[model samples]
Target: MSRLKNLKKLLTVLRVALSLVAACTFSTVSSAALEESISQPPDDYVLVRRVIDARYFTPESVVSRPDAAGTQGSEETWPDIKLRPSLNLKEALQSNIAREITISEQDALSKVVLREYGFGQKNSLQAYAAIEEKIVELNDLGAPENLKAGAVIKIPALPRMALSEPNLLNKYNKIPKGSMYPSLSKVTSFDAFNPVTQAFTEKPVVSGDGRDGSPLVIEHLWLPKDYKDHLGGIELDQSYEEVQAQVISVNMESESLAEDYQSIPFLSAEERMIIKSKLSGQPKLKPVLIVLDDGWPNDEAFYDSRKFVSEALEMIKKRFNYPVALQHPSSQSRVFTDYPKEAFHARSIHKSLATLVELEPSRVWDDQRVRVVYIPLSTAQVYSKAMLEELVVLRLIDDFMLGARGDPVPDKEVKAKRKIARDIVKRLKQDIGVKDLSTDKAIIESALVFADLYAVASGNPYVVNFSWTTRKREHKFTHFDFNQGILVSAAGNSSLNNCKSCRPNLAYSKECECADNAAAEERWFAVRSVSNQDVVAVMNTARDGSLQCRSSIVGSRSVDPLAISFNGYVSDSICGTSFAAPRVAWLFAAKLAYIPPQEFSIYDAPDKGHKLREIVKKSRQGGASGDQYGLDIKKLFEN
Candidate 1:
């Protein structure tokens, strides 16, 4: 009996072990299947599928819509990689200190320069040796960042200070007063299939004369498709294609915005004294505008249909005499937002910057918060869609899976975006002699562009960035609605669609409705995100009319913006429509006397919505997220 019992127990243990193995195998298969079902652009990159069985994935190419419109104002180089001559720094220091510290024949130490640029101990040793010969007299210096590194600095071959950085990040500081401000500058420098040039082109400037403190008014002149032929009285050359470039810089007809009243909003443009009376203290108007040159000119966005926008600007300018203007877009930013999921990896800031420089502006204002948005000069995928399609015939990656999310990056997405980053580096090295671009190029370029632009217009102080909220897909951009944009969204905890206010089945914001058709939901989410994301920069507008979602309350920063946020209401509550951005704009104009613009692209700013909120808070009546339409204008000048 004992022997029989032992046999039974042993058999039972073996059976249990076998079942476990089967279960594990089943789980492994299931997980792989899920991943494969969603895996996008296939490995055979040569055959791109724009459609799944006759249903288009990417929208068929079309003459895109208009984009230029906004409040605005708004300009690099190549490395001549030659060996630097070595310098006996001690001797060079005897000369003019600042001049001596710059790159001269005496400072070129080939070996040291190569080493500084990271030629490795072996690769460019001889090149360094050759350059070191030129750096004869040395002016070994103290660290501008710190003296502890025991480092020697050399200038580029050019007569000016040219530098290659390879060290821990130096402490960054805000641009000091009386300095230039770099506004949101798009990508400034990068390799491209074709080099960017500013010399004469048939394309006319769409955004014109829209900068802070600029007294000039810009206007566009409607012209025929081949109108470039008549600009200089020479029918030079313009394709007889469907092209519309009618933009010109014009002068403000009235000296003060109040000179043209009755047409604009609050103050009369025809009466300057009216505005002067309102400015009890030191009152000055700094007119500005922002325009994105995404595609074709948007006539509907201007006086024709967007009369309200023009009215608003006029009202503000006339009310306080702050000038404003904006209009543009011909094709860019697509590279930043639209890469395929498998291929979309945020590379170095330098991977796509254009080398187009203009004479630096003479005066840069420092009142309004200015920020910049950079566009890469090259993405390889940008040159042509056909070329990109040919390169990616197989679909291994999904079309809309994401390359980067908000500043608080999700680990899973981060890992995936970087999965092919190493491959990107390898390709760049082979294509243009760069590796680790994600680390090396992108960040560096952003810093440089923002820094330079900031220097030009340091006056605009409190920055609200709209760069990272970018997308590549297509969707409509309806700036305001009955409710939504005006409210602070509560990050609700439920099984609802992330983007949808509630469930999908219900037509709109009827929270109780649920349309759980997985396939339809997937397709709906795949709409092009660019129009949905870029044009309508998300903002904090809850104070005046922004509704607050009960679940997601924003109470992070003390100086958080008291803009607009909604609160839990009954189903019958109709408030804080998704189209409530105007209140933020209106509030901004009202508080212009308090907040100044900075040119740096708010690179260090927390969430833009939060930053905007913080700015309002730091200002006079930015108390809390409640309605305060009767704002006090005096506290602005007091502090």
Candidate 2:
């Protein structure tokens, strides 16, 4: 009887062990399946994929839109390797200094030069003279019109006594009796790309008659499609047929924006009152436009560029009566190795906030509050559809899913980090008065964008998948709703010489398709400009006058009198449509002062400021194209 009982116990134990093993195997298999599911493409993207399919993907074959309402037949091509123009402002100042010192945002070039190269405070005049000499040296190299931070400039080697023959550029400063302002110039030195010149072209003798138009107006320009034809008045020989391309670049016209606006309820009575109070008087009309760029110059370039940008702002304010600010945040910060490039971009944005507060004291309404947005450049170098969608998902999860419910995530450490990030984002959002980031709305007036997004995109092959297309549409929608104040964009710099696909288009053949889809999107509304063309062309849509550039994506949409300068103070030498966007932004800011209360009310509407289409309605002027009227600001603003 004892042996039988023992056998029963052994059988039970064996059965229990077997059950445990089976359960363990089931759990392992289930976990593996879950991971596999996560690894696969999300359902939305399952039907579509990136052409390059990598972290850094570049689109191949950029052709102009065949059906585009702008100039057709000329296909713009972008190359795998970019060949941009280069100018060295730091080197220009090198001969005058004993050694160069890196500059900071807060440092004044005059004071710094005085401290490093001056004899003493008693010899202030002499120090000022030395600084003047350095300024002239910079101008010769086609430096940015303003003083830039984050570059290295020279400490003049000349003794204070030697520079005492009166500062050559001192007369340019227009500060009040007690304020000391840096020398600034409206004249740009950097040779801008000229579709007419077939090469980088300089301004043909600035008009002494002075611009009669509103300083705030933005002119969109495109690169010349046929360089030889424009410059030599002779058609150039071509090797291949033109490639028909379609670029759905973001197009934010007034009509689509108006429709978008109606969907959102107009501001409440209280909100309207608040807006009225803030923007009531002309004094409140101070429009703060910001020019943002990517890429940092060498240490030497940083010094010169910082000072140049600073001085340029002052100059524009005094001469054009335009209050424009600039912020070029680079991936390379002071401690270049410490953080990722994205961090630096965030820093640049923060810097723009600081700058706004400094430029206009009233901007501190709620502890240095300022509205901000993002406007893509012509090249689409600042973003990709995949990356942009990733950002949206991250924002939704962090701001709503995880934190909105006021519940802590299961992981304590992750929750803590997210909390910190959330705080920062919340602070900025409030400052900009952004009620919700979930949809595209214009709650902010300022914007931030990178020019390199297009430059980088040029290297990848085009993807026509649903995911890519949808993301792009979403991105444009976001920008459209991001700012109620205004939208400013750059017409890309892809021209015959720089873009690989452009050469074949000289013959007007159909062999390459390198159009930028971003340029075609309809959410683009505010202002856009190119560098070389004359008479800014308005697009086919009644509200499409906003589209500008010579990429052939916009058939016959050529504009004239567009101007740009090299950011010589920042780097060895580089120029692009990216730089032109900021210049246009500055111009637009100048016109803000003239905006009437009635016109400003557009922001309070659902469409925000979409009804304010001031690009094509404005009068035109002739200069390089001869005997034509110039862009008349008085008529555009007054009308």
The best candidate by lDDT is 2
Task: Identify the candidate with maximal TM-score.
Answer: 2
**Off by more than 4 A, model 1:** 1-297, 300-553, 557-615, 618-639
Please write out the lDDT profile of model 2 over residues 523-551, one tens digit for every residue.
Answer: 13212223222212221100111112322
Worst 10 residues of 1 by lDDT: 173-182
Q: State how far residue 49 of model 2 sits from its true place (Å).
A: 18
lDDT of 2: 0.27
* Per-residue lDDT value at 34 in model 2: 76
Per-residue lDDT value at 363 in model 2: 42
